[model samples]
Target: MGVLSICFVSFVILFLISLILFTIGMNFLFNDYTIFIEWELVSLNSSSIVMTFLLDWMSLIFMSFVLLISSLVIYYSSEYMFGDIFINRFIMLVLLFVLSMMLLIISPNLISILLGWDGLGLVSYCLVIYFQNEKSYNAGMLTALSNRIGDVALLLSIAWMLNYGSWNYIFYLQTMSGDLEMSVIGGLVMLAAMTKSAQIPFSSWLPAAMAAPTPVSALVHSSTLVTAGVYLLIRFNILLVDTWAGQFLLVGSGLTMFMAGLGANFEFDLKKIIALSTLSQLGLMMSILSMGFYDLAFFHLLTHALFKALLFMCAGAIIHNMNNFQDIRYMGGLSIHMPFTSSCFNVANFALCGMPFLAGFYSSDLILEVVSQSYINMFSFFLYFFSTGLTVCYSLRLAYYSMTGELHSGALNVLNDEGWVMLRGMMGLLIMSIIGGSLLSWLIFPTPYMICLPSYLKLLTLVVCLLGGFMGYLISSVKLYFFNKSLIYYKLSWFLGSMWFMPYISTYGLISNSLVLGGTVYKSMDQGWSEFIGAQNLYMNLVNMSKYVSSVQNNNLKIYLMFFVFWIIILVSMMIFV
Candidate 1:
């Protein structure tokens, strides 16, 4: 069969599967938990494999979003990757990746959940390396290796939990407690989460991951692999509730959000900017989820998947026209030529900037309100508030560079609109991004449909968003560079960007000392101690005996066998005597 035939078949299969899952999930959509056991994998007397489904308002909502967006990304890839030799392989991996994420959402067991989790990571890494370029391979290595560190901590925590309680998800919830040590384990698990979610010290790998194709970026950033960490926390919310670890995570998420938003403000590469923005957004979601607002966080994840995927797809179309170049400086005034992509890009960006009536506006507004309700420490308060400013600063920068600036004209025809299939996908997502947020009241929000925040806070958020858009406009108009004269901003960006190097630096120092110590120890053993008379004499006796035996060697197999037989008899007799 042709690649197109196979691709269409795969999409149809996935579409049918998701529709069925979506129906079942929606059927069980209550505010409380409902568990449907597919098969009993383990019991006291026997063990077997089975499938299961668990649903709540949050899981069902996010599952529906994952299935919907993932199906679109798959279809987008078909046309986007047409005529490419590795299209079939890429499709297979993508299908598996989507499958794993869906499985993770509905998993009734932590072990099964993790199986899906690792599968997503593995498949993402594979997709990162799909282009078979050196840079792609290196980025894939860093991304995979960094996530591995987190995965180890997760595995250890799960092992501890399983030993103490049970492996089943509901039973694990029944076993949940706020023990001090369990909080510590929770902290470790959050550490794993921070790494996987690309927070603070573990965040450098995310921008590096821009070497992947645009669809892969869409896949990673949009509600699938990158959001899994936040989903994990939400899945185990029973255990994480009312713990110091939860508090710590709330603070960690705040910091990550601010840092990532700031980083995206000055990024030159279009995808890297989105990548950093994603990190920050995930951080915000983590913070919100940590505060027992799983519904809000998952709703944000849902909207983010829609808008961000739209953003990346439009950006992908731009890059595709530009012969795969991603520099923001080289792209400008593209709205005139590629009207559809440009329109989608602008709508997505507006939604991303949290404009009212758009998806990001509702989700981000909910998060900010949740933060206000949950703030306890002065530190947390400052971080949460400050991150709002950075979020505006960066999201607007993406808008300014791509739509309104002076075009870099050196590369002729390196700028064009995407084909019908790609544009259709972008337009669909754009519409969803605009209207999806308002629907949250009916879908994921715990409260009824109404304006939910205070008037002053709403004003403040609107002012911030407008001010950010204006600031981006001014900066782009003048071609203002933050690092040119601003030493403080430079230092801050450097600090955040280079934070992941600490461990490698420490390892370098330790290895240097260890090598010096090892050499000294070897010298003493070889030159100083062995040079002494008695030690050298003892060593020489063994060496000389081996040398004397060497003189008795013969080329003839018969002679060697005769001597070997004689020694065997003597050795047997000695063994009997002993």
Candidate 2:
């Protein structure tokens, strides 16, 4: 019948498909089977799970997350975009993206994986521009082009891997050390991963992607696209160990975590702050993966999915209620008007901060403990510790400013809540964020070496949370003049407040260096290409010479007849050739 009904049906179908996958996953956990579709070769081998190695613990965790987050997004969209013109189109793309990501998680070969990865990237590009605004369109273009760079690297690495090792995922793991080409291919593939995971130079597009709707932002940042890079690393972790690339990822991830956490300290825009925080959190996860702790990385990915999705959805509700203004300074005393949303946001924030007994606390603590145990090297130990503190600071800062500051006098008009659909989505996630850590420990990471943390670390974690929250409160309340002033003041506030500029700085530096190098080469060459194009002086001389020909350019009957005859001759020649 109508677009909304069709969209509703599609979402229902997607959920049913996800349920089937979940059931199959459970079966794989106990039984072995061969799956055949057309000429495709699919087999489940011996492991903790009889599922294909592609559907191991790592993929299952992320797949479950994708299904849950995607379903929530669809449910929320039905209400948020009830009367929108492109509701069906948006739902279709969303379903397609989810399907592609699911396929990516279970792809047993590099070729199949790349296909799914590229498909998801393409759908994300479309989603970013769904609003059809100039800003949304530009952000979509940037995300598409930047992600394509990663896709190219992935394709090249896949070709290299197939040529060196066998064309199967399992074969690569077995042959990694036996063949040098495996190392080379793995390194090249990791470069692509670094880009996809929003590490360093490729990190800029993510913040710009915030131009999309809040739900889309939540989906992209929390559970779906952003983790794709880290998931890639976890998928191929064993193959990447003992390589220089692995070491590089470790160091790179640490630096990213530290710097991005610092960057979030200055951000005022709600989404951009979380975007930077996502980059940092991913960096932390990548570091663990680099250190050869895939289980910890996977657990981190799971906990991150819970808390970060809740945070983003809560942010979405806040944005929706506040008429789409994402400035934290403009939102204060929300706990008074919207207690449930505020409470959900606060719990998720504390979880993100890794305060004791919270979802983030146990996951982050376990990761640090694993790192300390694995890398006896002091450098790795302290890097993780510093990152933990940074996480605490930024997460606390995020919760503090929005919940406890002075409400802006000119803040947006507020409704009581976003809606039942939106609340349902957020509430589900909030429950998970609160209890995900214990669930993760029970389901995965059943390692005997895992120790319960001493009470001192718990106390220290709470102290840091309180310190971070108070610091944010003081900064926001005391700096109210600068926080809300003239347009110029707002610009300065944004400048001081935005951490998304680092990528642009890198992008600018890249362009500037290229231009300078090109200029130097041009100046040094004896046979100048510029001369062949005709210089400014030569063009001026040509203009002067054209003055002499002006006398022959008179508009007269003879000139018109001459031109008409010339045109006729050309047309006649063309007709003859035809």
Candidate 3:
């Protein structure tokens, strides 16, 4: 069969499976049923190794979402990556990526989790570098190395758990929460989650990872790889809340959210803007999970997954039509040319802004209200509300630049939404983006949360959103005077626009000096002094000595006579001395 047919079949099968799993998850949730299956792998000298899988409502539902998204992504890739020589390879890599995520979702054992975790890191690296360019190679390296930090953290947690005589972390989270040593394990796990989720210092890789294909972005950034950290933290929430680690995460995630939102406002690359938005939402999930609201985080994770996947799909369609021009400056009036894709894009964008009754509103609005009701410090409070406004600001700015203005692309651009395969893939998630929020809200929370606050506090989200939308429009529609003022403050603009130089800090700042030092060592030790005194010098000396010996043995007549006379003289002297 053709690659396209294979992808279509996979999509249909996965879609059916997702529906079944969703139904089963609902049943499990209603009954509070958790199924744990264990198989003995080895037993020796009072230690036993086993593989375990947990099928709870959470895992089931999350798996359903993952599969659902993967199916659509595969279907989408059939068209997006069409006619590529390695289309088969791309499909296989995608399947492997999904498999790794499923393994992660189902396993409760730390060791087993590592299997899937490393798989994700490895497969994502391959996918990121699939285009075989220097940019993709660099991006893939950054992504792999950053995730390696988390892998090491997970390994440490596993070793620490070995003190408890098993790697199954689910059974021991409560026990580990109170013990000091176990708290260290918790800290290690939190560190791992931070790297995986791209929080604070480890966040540079998320935007860089856009070097991958758009289908991979839709899968990895939206529902699978990035969310793995949030999901891990959600699983470990029992040990995370009310601890120093949780507090640290809360602050870090808040700053990450703010930083990403600010960065998105400055980004011109269409994919990177969406990537930054994903980073912002990830921060939201991490922050809420740290605040002991795992369910809310999970809820947002699911809802975010729906719209984000759709958002990326829509982005893929636009980029595909634009001849791969991902810069927003090269795009405008696409709404008129590509109506279906544009409509889907706007829906996802509005959902991202948490427009009322959209998918994002149910979770994002609830998260904001919950934060307001909580007793967080003023700094955190500001971060929450300000970042919310920033989210809206970037979303509207994106829409304004890409969909509403006059046509800015070149004359040769054939901007149309004629790819039915891509559109069908988006159509599935578009429907979900419209209703997935309310649907998930109903399923996840059998009883509604009672949010009690004063009128002004209740209206805070709306007010911030309105102000943010206005600012977005203003920023995008700035006149020459304001633009000149921005040029004057170029340093500040560059700093904020560059994600506070995080990419620099992560790549050059972290490694450039070391690389320079390495070069110095290579020159002085490997090439200069060491070469002069070591192998090169020894070889030269040996060569000179060999030459002298060969000359003596050349059997030249004068040399032979002189050698014989010298030997005779030496013999006579030895005889006289005797």
Candidate 4:
């Protein structure tokens, strides 16, 4: 078989394995059974070092979904990266990425989890820089360093867990809930999760990581890397449910959701807009998880993964046909040229907007209702609904720019949805995106949520969604008079468009001052004071002393005689004194 067939074969195998795993996971869920397998490597001082695996419905089902998404991604990449010389390398990296995620999902021990966690950070860095350009390098560095913060936090948590003499945190989560030390660990873990999930201050990297190929973006943003933090918190939900850390996450994630949604509205780059949407959805997941509804968070996570992956694939196809131009302004009337892709794109877009009966609707609608019924402050309530509206606004704005309106690109451009391989990959996710939400809602929840609210409150979600959609259409189709108004208010536009300067705050804003300080320190110490007092000054003194000694040693005849006479006189004087 050809090297390209490797990916196709892998996809088929993974697809079958995913189905089997899903079946097993469903059985486990129905039986409410957990299986733990452990292999002890060493025993010392009544403490044992062991590798532990936990098999329950949650891990198994999550793994199954992960594999399913990964297989489709690999299949898509075969066509997307078809002409590249390093296709095999790309496939291997993707498989490694999947393996790391699998390891993360199954391992119950902190030590083992770290192995997977670090694997994710490292492999993602490699994948981000796969293009080998300055832009890719900078983005890769940002992505790696941002994730490193989370890695350190995870390590700290593991160290703190040593107090309990076991790295299997599942055993201690219940007993350690009220403990001060455990709280500290939980805080560290939360910090780690925030970084991994790109919450608030750490969010810039998520959009920046669009440097990777589209297939990798689909996998990383949708299921593997970004979701790692949410999954970690899901496992540690017992520790976070009623704590200060949980409250902190709630505030941070809510703000993150708002920031990303608003930012997407102002973004022009197609991939980054989707990346921002992923960030927004991640914030939604984290926020609900913080509110102690981890099951809802997990549900949203799965549903989001399905549609978001399909969304990116459609984006990839569009970008491919557009000669790699990612600017949405350069795209219009694509729905006329590429009917199938546009259809899939609209489905994914509406699904993201939580259109009734679609995948996102099942989870996002439920989340809104739950938040509405909860006893949160008015500000939190506003943030929750306002952010939901923003989600719809951006989705519609994206569709308007790309799928509707007059053709914006050059007249000679050609567009078609002809890549059967690419379409086949999208087709799998497309089916899942349509039905995955209701299927998961039915399977995951044994009992339905009882959402009791007044008519106004119950209708609020639909109202906000409608308003958001209307605003999106209006904003995209602004009149020339309003365009002049936008120009007049350019500063406001710039601020909102720039993610409120978060990219600066995370990157240049944080590093520029430190770099200047480093330069000053280098001049004063390494070049100035150190040169005067250290090896340079010592070398000069040694050179002068050596010259004087050499002059004395280079005796002429007259000088030698004078020296001999002086020595004779000194000897006689000493003899007389004796």
Q: Write model 3 residue lDDT over 1-578, tens digit each, in one string.
A: 99889999999999999999999999999999999999989999988788899999999999999999999999999999997989999999999999999999999999889999999999999999999999999899889988999999999888788888778888888898888667898799899999999999999999999999999999998889999999999999988888999999999999999999999998999999999999999999999899999999999999999999999999999998888899998889989999999999999999999999999999999999999999899999999999999999999999999998778888988888889999999999999999999989998887999999999999999999999999998888866346476679899989999999989998897756656788999999999999899999999999999999999989899999999999999999999999
Cα lDDT of model 1 by residue, 221-282, tens digit? 98888888888777667666677777778877887887777667657888888888898889
Winner on TM-score (1 vs 2) = 1
What overall lDDT goes with each candidate model? 0.75, 0.74, 0.93, 0.92
C-alpha root-mean-square deviation, each candidate? 6.4, 9.5, 4.2, 4.2
Q: What's each prediction's clash count?
A: 0, 2, 0, 0
Model 4: how large is the Cα RMSD against the reference? 4.2
| TM values, all candidates | 0.83, 0.79, 0.90, 0.90
Sort the predicted structures by lDDT, highest score first: 3, 4, 1, 2
Location of the lowest summed lDDT over 10 successive residues in candidate 3: 478-487
lDDT of 3 at 87: 93
Off by over 4 Å in 3: 43-47, 480-483, 514-578
Candidate 4 per-residue lDDT over residues 194-310, each given as its tens digit: 999999889889999999999999999889999999999999998788789999999999999998998898899999999999999999999999999999999999999999999
Which of the predicted structures, 1 or 3, would earn the higher lDDT when compared with the native?
Answer: 3
User: What is the model-wide C-alpha lDDT for candidate 2?
Assistant: 0.74
Residue 98 CA error for candidate 1 (Å)? 1.2
Candidate 1 stretches with Cα past 4 Å from truth are 30-33, 41-57, 449-455, 479-578
Model 1 TM-score on a 0 to 1 scale: 0.83
RMSD value for candidate 1: 6.4
Model 2 ranges with Cα > 4 A deviation: 2-7, 16-20, 23-38, 41-53, 376-379, 409-412, 452-474, 477-501, 509-578
The model with the greater lDDT, 1 or 2, is: 1
